[model samples]
Target: MTKAITLRADHGSDDLRRLARASRDAAQTRRLLALAAIYDGASRTEAARIGGVGLQIVRDWVARFNAEGPAGLVDRKAPGKSPRLGPEQRVALVQAVEAGPKPESHGVVRWRLVDLVRWMQDRFGVSVSRQTLGRELRRMGLRKLSARPQDQAQDPEPLEAFKKTFPPSWRRSASSCPRKPLELWWQDEARVGQKNGITRRWARRGTRPRAPHDQRTTWAYIFGAICPAKGKAAGLVMPYANTEAMQAHLTEISAAVEPGAHAVLILDQAGWHMSTHLAVPENITFLPLPPRSPELNPVENIWQYMRENWLSNRVFENYDDIVAHCCDAWNKLLAEPTRITSIGFRTWAHGS
Candidate 1:
């Protein structure tokens, strides 16, 4: 016959009562109640009944409590399998990954899971499963990364030099006077898609009208300058985007700004804006935006509106059609200076 078990008041003081009261979760409350009952001179079976758990679970808890004290009764570490790769093997695996794949022996463009497995087998004479290798890679913080061929061949010197010399600042001289008039100026480029389509509904009940499709054409590039306060704008549509094309666009913008007493031309860090090929005019000052921050440009919102409202649904047959439509949209935007100013000041409101 099995020996009869007796419970004793093992928990010191009234701490278990406080724990039972403080426990919010149902499972935790039950566990604390069971422990409290066991501590209050109840049998294991009696404690299990009060706790609403099995007798075996109560006995297990008591055994754990006796073995490793109160912490042992709370929870134990999960039983998990040990890692296959030893410390030395793990270090070797990291070294192999850092060295990259050997193309001559592996006969592959890049390293794959199977290739890694094979490489490890041949190089270290240790056979490792694909799953094990993947786990090891993950443990070592290795992630899938791609490299472009051009990125490998790029020279950093020219880019560094260009960064250093461009955008030279000139302080206002004491003798210099402000120009004719002051205007809030904005300069930006927009792309026109030559091939575009529009969807329409027909009068017939069951069928929808299909719009014409034009695939051979593309959108014209429009470089525009606008005054927010006066609602006046000047723009030039061109075939391509380059320093020469931008210089031509700037020529037109310079004439417009010539009448303004103060002009601030807000433009992005495009290649044309920073190119050494063009000379910076004295009257017109270029306000360079921080790199890659397109959200700060209000002209972006104008282009977004233009695309969604006017250009999105309509289909154009050729470049000429695209240019005409874009010019019309540009004129319409110029007519609404408040809208432009509101959109431009979006970031400004948020302390950008």
Candidate 2:
């Protein structure tokens, strides 16, 4: 027979009963009341019966209460199975995620959970399930997100430099434009056509929902520009993506600029945009983003928002129908100015 550990003398049976009454945790309250029974001169067997546990468990509880007072009675999270991946393995996994898998070596463009599991087995001789690896990735603060499209020939250095220098450049050019208030506008062109894509839709688990997709090639260009700060937008639906169409679009943008304010238009270095033949308005100045860096333009996001919300999953009857749909979508977008601000605002360009 083991000797019982002496509980702390400061907390008596009355103190424990009072604490038990006040305690919110039901398990903690039960343990406290059982200990109160023991404090009031009840036998350990009687205390065990009060706690609904065996005598050994009662003894264990007494040991814990003696060590840590009422807090010891509280339920603790059970430490489950140990992680299969060690610290060094976790670091390696993070590195692998940051530096995406090579297509030639990994035989896949993207790293899937199964691929990672196989890689872990090959790299460290540890077997982990996809579900477990997913848990680990989530624990590491990694999530699956859609990748942004970038041109193959894009220069990362210039793109980074452009973002860094954009604020100062805007300030300097803003003074030269000689407008009381300068509006920053992001410009881009998207093709809305009969050849429409199917976007994601809500459906029951393990079931695929179908949407209308078109194969016809007829399309029209939407020359779109947005001032995220003011939640202002200008757009033109055009038959072609040429200097004439660009000129028309620029004029429309110029007309749309607020009274007594000049527009500093940021755009990609498209041929139609940079053409010497096209006459730029005095109220608008061109600031071309680095070549092949479409991500720098917020209008890209606007196009994506429009396509996802309104333009996608539809079949157009003809060129006129495409134009009408494009107009309707753009108008719907303009109706919600806050949507424009939310979609197009960039901290790098607009500043806090």
Candidate 3:
């Protein structure tokens, strides 16, 4: 029964039609075109037909257009329900996750979404679905990832000290090496064999995908090294992991170095790596990492990448086939030098 709101006098049918054409939002364009019909002296019923809505919606659009112009017609995100977890609750959740579950109390080694949901209900009397909890966890910058391996016997004190002293040692090694330039190389070995494990693959939701899993024992060792800064690598597909193989790998790595550059090869101290019988290369110096710390070397990640992409889920006929596959995988990795740079690069080892 009340009078309809007046639209802004500055915009005519032509102006509104132009604005409608320029608008990216479909709903906003519809509202603009409906208002244009009104400016053209069309009945409210006609404008409602243009908007594909009832007269009430057209009247609401008219009111919005009269108040704030075209922008007011644009869609606004709906204000949903308030957060289920408060600031204090969020802090508590982070602490509980970091501290991990007490096996005696929680009866689980790891925290799962359902387990966390139960925990929230028991501790704070809050009810949340797994999907909602997942969304909240992601919003809090958390993700489910495989945990890195850490030896129980690892001495944290020396490891921390070693990390702190890395820069000084790096500088000393650079100064000691006889070359105009220096190359930092990470070295490690991985055993690729017929007993290869399967990797994850994309599939439809609620369906599981499978890959070939071999149980044969035949294996080949990949003695690999990468100079991340140069995006270059040197490797040898060896039959065994011993002093002889290590010597051969060191020689290969030395040869891969630039003509005038000395390489500081950072590697873990295996028995062969520390063997006095192994001849040291003139162009390369060894920087042995602390014991039980394979994670310190980026070459471990290179091995993981190789296994996931090329070497996994396959059955090799024999030792020869294993060797061939290892070589092929290494060659494929070398072909993509940028992949080496991306996978092997460490900010601390390389730079900012």
Candidate that would win on lDDT: 2
CA lDDT, candidate 3, residue 268:
94
The residue-by-residue lDDT of candidate 3 on 171-223, one tens digit each, is 57868754468889999999988888788878999998888888778888999
Model 2's lDDT to the true fold?
Answer: 0.91
Candidate 2 local lDDT, 117-146, one digit each (tens): 999999999999999999999999999987
**Best of the two (2, 3) by lDDT:** 2
Alpha-carbon deviation at 28 in model 1, angstroms: 2.4
Reference-based TM-score, model 1: 0.48
Q: What are the per-model numbers of colliding residue pairs? A: 7, 0, 0
Q: Candidate 1 overall Cα lDDT vs. reference?
A: 0.67
How well is each residue in 1-352 modelled by candidate 1, as lDDT tens digits? 5553443445642666676677556655566677777666677778889877787787776666556545554544688977767788788778777777667866877778898888777767778899888988997999776442233544656444434442232112211445344444667888778566453434687777665566765667988776655556678888888898789877877777645355566677899988989876656666675555454456766776677667766777677888888888877777777777666653232223
- Estimate the TM-score of every prediction: 0.48, 0.89, 0.78
Q: 1 or 3: which has the higher TM-score?
A: 3
Query: 93 in model 3: Cα distance from truth in Å?
Result: 2.4
lDDT head-to-head 1 vs 3, winner: 3
